[model samples]
Target chain A: MVRIRNLRKSYGSYQALRGLTMEIPRGELFGFVGPNGAGKTTTMKIIAGLMRADSGEVVVADRMLSGKTGQIREMVGYVPDFFGVYDDLKVQEYLEFFASLYGMDGKEARRRTAELLEMLGMTQLRDEMVDGMSRGMKQKLCVARALVNTPELLILDEPASGMEPRYRRQLKELLQELCAEGMTILISSHNLNELAEMCTSIGVISKGRMVMQGDVPTLLRRQRETNPYVLQCLSFPEEAIQILKSDPHVKNIASSGTNISFPYDGTEEEAAELLTALVAKGAQIVSFYREEGSLEKMFLDMTTVP
Target chain B: MRHLNPVYKIGLKQSARTKKTVVLLLVYNLLLSGLGLVVFYLTFDRAGRVREDVAYSGILTLYSVMAAMEFVMILFIVPASTAGAVAGEREKQTLDILLSTKITPFHIVTGKLAASISMVILLVISSMPVLSVVFCIGGVTVSALFVFLLLLVVTAVYIGSFGIFFSVCCRKTTGATVCAYLAMIIVVILLPGLLFFFECLEAFGSVGYIGIRNVMNTISGKRTLFLLFNPVISFVSMLRDQVGRGISIMNSIGSEGGLFYFLSRHWFAASMVSQLVVSAIMIALSAHRLNPTRKGWKSGRSG
Candidate 1:
């Protein structure tokens, strides 16, 4: 779990994070979506303790981050957007080297390296030089490197940037598996649709501010509340109007010829009953539906300038 | 060394694997071999013509030249190898990943310096054949080789610490390398230049260079402390103790009963101890600079 409060960071005259506040609960596959220069990476760096926030209180894995990086570094794993490989090290040696950095014993490091290489499907490439690997392969290795410590919180900044489509899907599945295994993952990316398909919860940030955040279904349902249930009758309009006007769940009802639309504050069961009543009254309903709200649509609605 | 530093492992493995190290080894041995053989032929050429003791003492000259040459080579190589230690990590974008691990800042600095020191030690050890040209003939003791080897390692560490310190301070490898060399230049060339200027000041308001050593005897003892920072002066002072005054370049040699005389008597120990302490301090400062979350250490200028 991570809790960031009013995190502020500045690069010269540019304010990277200004009063940015967010939280990722335990076992959360939290997606951090924001436009470029929207403080996503800055906030991730602050949480990972790779950077110092100018003025803010950040609590990571229940430890209060107060200028001490070592205390939190052990609990948080970080994978940067862009990273280079050691030119001389083999893939297995590279992973083992990082495992050793976390103070793992030689045998433990070797076992962990083997396990990670297997998980990454890099067992065949373990002996290959890391520098000669493809960009996508290198990115996957970095992800495995971040996990070598078995950290509780994994902060990934644009992890899928260089990954191919197939690897990106595998990465999503792997992240979901990790989250299911009780690891909290905070992944930031520019792709809302990709995140929507995998993330349990999502947050939209803009101008160093968290504009919106909620669970996927709840956020989508909240957006859906703005749309009205419409009913268009090809015939028998008077009977449908009479049944709708008598309904207590419908408000702001408007009927013109056979077309009717109104806000409905009722459960699905109650709506079903109302529709039956309309049929019983000889109402011929041609179209009766509300449009579904998507995460991308909501992200654009929140982020795009009016 | 219960837990060997991971950085040290990688640093050593990568540098040793490079063709540069092998080439350097070949070049170093060849150069020292060339110098040694030249001295060898010249000494044997005077074998029958010169006295027996005089011919043997020529071996001492060979020893001093090899040791001095190794020291200078270390001076150039250590900085070039280590100036990019941390800055190169930054350029490669691996510094943050390494810093984010359980390894402390001091650990990284020590690992880097240790790796470089090990490489320089390898070079020194491999040059033993060329140096055996002197010891094989006789005159220079094995104890003297041990002492010189120790001196060489200490000087490498001292110079390597400045390079790593500059690596931590500067963002660019070029900037860090330049600063490291400049720091060495100050300690090697300028520090002794200051001592020479002090001798000149003592010789001022007098006629000519009237018995420079005699005048140096009257100078303050504190002036000789500056020579402690100059590894070359301490090395010559050290070599003089091992051999005799034939090779000493120390200007304050005859300052009787003064601080200069006291320090000059123990110049090798004083310089090594002083430099080790300074190296420790530079390493500590570098470790401090390498840390990202340390408050009040960062320049507010960046952001």
Candidate 2:
């Protein structure tokens, strides 16, 4: 749904992006993760045609992202980290204004505005001033505005930034639902935990470069040797920790009272065998399982300087 | 080809919410009408007050007030209306979101510029009664008032476009507003002062005041062309034509059958052509300003 190659954006002496290349498939929810000054927002802006790239090419829905900005704009829906709402305009009016800008006529604009407002659960507040809305509500309204044209590619930059926990969850669910509906979504976010939960694929960027990009499960599996496992014991937990720490396959181990978690360099089966060995040695084991790796770990691992 | 009614709706609502703006417009209209009525009452018992000298002063005051009001309105309203147009969107971080829509940059520019001047147009329309009262009391014709109003609208649109253009270019609203005002002062006031000052410098030469006279003659001749860029000056010329003199003012001031005389005889066409050209340029400049990829120092590198 989107392709970017050798995209570089610089402001005076500072380079915001450096030959970043990425592709997102149709109906996929791609999470863009990076630390501060990682060129995430800059990449999104270039793809959305809000800023010019110093060099390189971006293609959205098979249309070049240069002179075809109007076409690209039609195909992409963007939600920025912070969005302004006109103080005097009502929620419906704001949506309608965008609809008209999209070339929809009066009747059609009104119809789409109503539909999107209802979809975003803003129908009840249609008459309310947009400025009077809560941060979450405004965020949702921005999402509604983005979807007013039913864009094929949604480029949302930190859409859930100021959203409360509940709304964040709702936004995640909504994104998942949209992806299921065959809408491709490219999202850049600081909240790795949430992105990991919902994104089908993820891209990690550092210093204006894409360090790693792949499906979440595949990324986790490739780095599975770094996965930590917890072994809960009913007795002799100290001995269990000492044994696990001494094991050649084990890298690091930590004990929390009866619960012990440590990195396992060996296969899952071998790790299970180690747990069995502990039990055979008169260590009563309650449960032994691998700890799930979150996108947070993957982000830190990718972005942290060597 | 899209129907801009939705933009129109939002624009109207946005302007209506500004109570301060509405009150200010109301005060302007009341003052204009009050001043016109006062003149009418004062001149009621006088004989031959409508003659050249008396009419010149009364109408000069009226025309001056009208031109000044339009200038002040454009000065205050354009910046207040358009200072935030694009910069504020960026500051609020909504510009990216807005640009991501199917709306082209041109559409966004037009919609924003339209929204800015929507209230100014409404206030101009609402001032019609007072404007007509000026005509009712004075010797000015209805066509003159209509033409003046048209001039005001054109000036407002041109000024509003500049404001939007600057707002789109600058990252800060304060900077955009200040620059727009400064540009206005240069075009309307400072440019003329510089021209006259040069003429005075030349007057001290061997040619004496003859150089000054020639310069003044040139200005009087090309008054319409000069005033075309400065709407306030054009408005002043329009008022001067309506109240004091006609094509003869050019001859009395200096040269005969020059640009001012030609414009005085064809004020409508001259004003239309000049305003249309200026408005188009302003609109084009504003559209160019909205281009995200346009060549500029601040243009970010894309990687």
Candidate 3:
């Protein structure tokens, strides 16, 4: 769990973070979304205790993280967007080095390294030089290094950047599995679809500020007053459209041959009654479904300048 | 006892793994052996036509030359070893990841400095056989050789710390290396030169005033204090002491009644202590520079 209050940071005349405040609860998979130079990385660094804020309060796991670095470091595992691996180090040595930095004993570090290498599917390449590996493999090793300490909170900054889709999907599933195991994760990325699929909650930042943040479904529902519904019929498409147009809640009707789509502002009971009404009208309906709003649309709607 | 520093361990392992280190050691050994053979041939060639005392003196001279050369080698090699330490981490984008760990900044700086100094120590120890030629010729004692080795290690640590300080302060490795060398030049050459210039001004009147003979005597008497932290002067003084000078060059500079006179009288100890103090200060400053949450410290750009 992380809580930030009115965090403000400036690099000379440039303001990187301004009055940014947000909170994530325990076991929540939070997605941090922002455009370029929006202070997403800045906030992540501040939480990771790798940077100092001009003025703010950051509390992670109920401990004040500003001046107390030892506890914060123990709790947070940070994966930077771009990081270099030691050229001469094998994958195993790299993980062992980081684990030892955290004061893990050699035996414990070896055990944890083995477990992490296996979990990240890097067991085959344990003895391989990190420098010779592909970028995706290197990134996975970086993530594994972070997890070596078994941190309760994982702070990843654009971790999926420059990765092939396969690696990205693997990372996504890995994060989802970790979140399921009660690890709180705060991930920042430009990939909206991936975040939309994996995140339990989302926060959108713009211009050094938090513009909007909430549960995913709540955010989507708030972005649109009425849910869009599509109805597909084998026959009587015109009669179906007419029947839907007559409904009080149905609006914005558009007909494309056998398919009719419209916006419906109604509860589930009303929607079910409408479906029954269409069935009773001798309309051979093939499919009737509500179209869920995409996170990309919500993100653009929230982030685009007025 | 506190569990070998992870950074130090990693640095040592990486340095040993590289072929560059092996090749460098090989080249270093070749150079020392060549220089040793040339000195031996020249010394014996002259001794064959001269008295027995001349042969003894030649061996002493050989000892002094090898010791001075080792000091100079450390001077050139330590900065190159350490100038790229923190700067390389920043350039390779591994600094943030390292900092994000629980290791303190002091640990990182000390680990880097220790790693660099250890390499220099390894080179010095490997050259011991070449230095033992003086022992075989009966001019240098084993204790003197050990003392010289200790001095070399201390100098390496001092210069290495200086380089690491610049590395932490500069964003680029080239800048750090240049600044480190410039600082070394100032310490080795400019400091002594300025001291001599001041003594000259005291001895021969500057402007319209006649020279104050008494003040000139006092200033000249304490002139050796200026070389207290100079590695070359310290090396030469110790070499002179080992080669039957009966007294260190430091005590012969002059005699007066002050702290400067005491430091000059015990120049070897003063030099070691002063160099260590300077090294500690530089290492502390470097640690401060790398600390992210420290006030007035700038944050490096992160990905």
The best candidate by DockQ is: 3
Rate residue B144 of model 2 by lDDT.
75
Q: How well does candidate 1 match the true structure in TM-score terms?
A: 0.89
Candidate 3 per-residue lDDT over residues A1-306, each given as its tens digit: 899999998888889888999999999999999888889999999999888888988999999876658779887899988866797899999999999999988898889999999999999999999989998898999999989889899999989898899999899999999999999999999889899899999999988899999998888777654558888888764565577879999888888988878888888789999999888888898998887777788878778988
Docking quality (DockQ) for each candidate: 0.39, 0.50, 0.54
List, residue by residue over B1-303, the lDDT tens digit for candidate 1: 437888898899988899999999999989988888887776765664564434667778777877888889999998988898998988888888898888899999999889888898999999987787776778788888888988998899999999999999988899999999999999999877777676676676464564555555555566666767778876787788887843333444444556656666677888899999999999999998888887654532221
The stretch of ten residues in a row with the least summed lDDT in candidate 1 chain A is A233-242
lDDT of 3 by residue, B1-303 (tens): 239988998999999998888887888878887888788777886566664434556887778777777888899989989999999999998998998888989999999999888888889888887878887778678999888988998899888888999999999999999999998889889998787667666655644343444333435545556677788777766765687553334444545557756766667778888899989999999998898888876875432
TM-scores of all candidate predictions against the true structure: 0.89, 0.87, 0.90
Q: Rank the candidates by TM-score, best first.
A: 3, 1, 2
Off by over 4 Å in 2: A228-263, A275-278, A281-283, B5-8, B45-76, B134-138, B206-215, B218-228, B244-249, B252-268, B297-303
Global CA lDDT computed for model 2: 0.75
Which model, 1 or 2, shows the larger lDDT?
1
Q: Rank the candidates by lDDT, best first.
A: 3, 1, 2
Candidate 3 lDDT at A259 equals 83
Ranked by DockQ, top first: 3, 2, 1
Off by over 4 Å in 3: A224-290, B49-54, B206-226, B244-254, B301-303
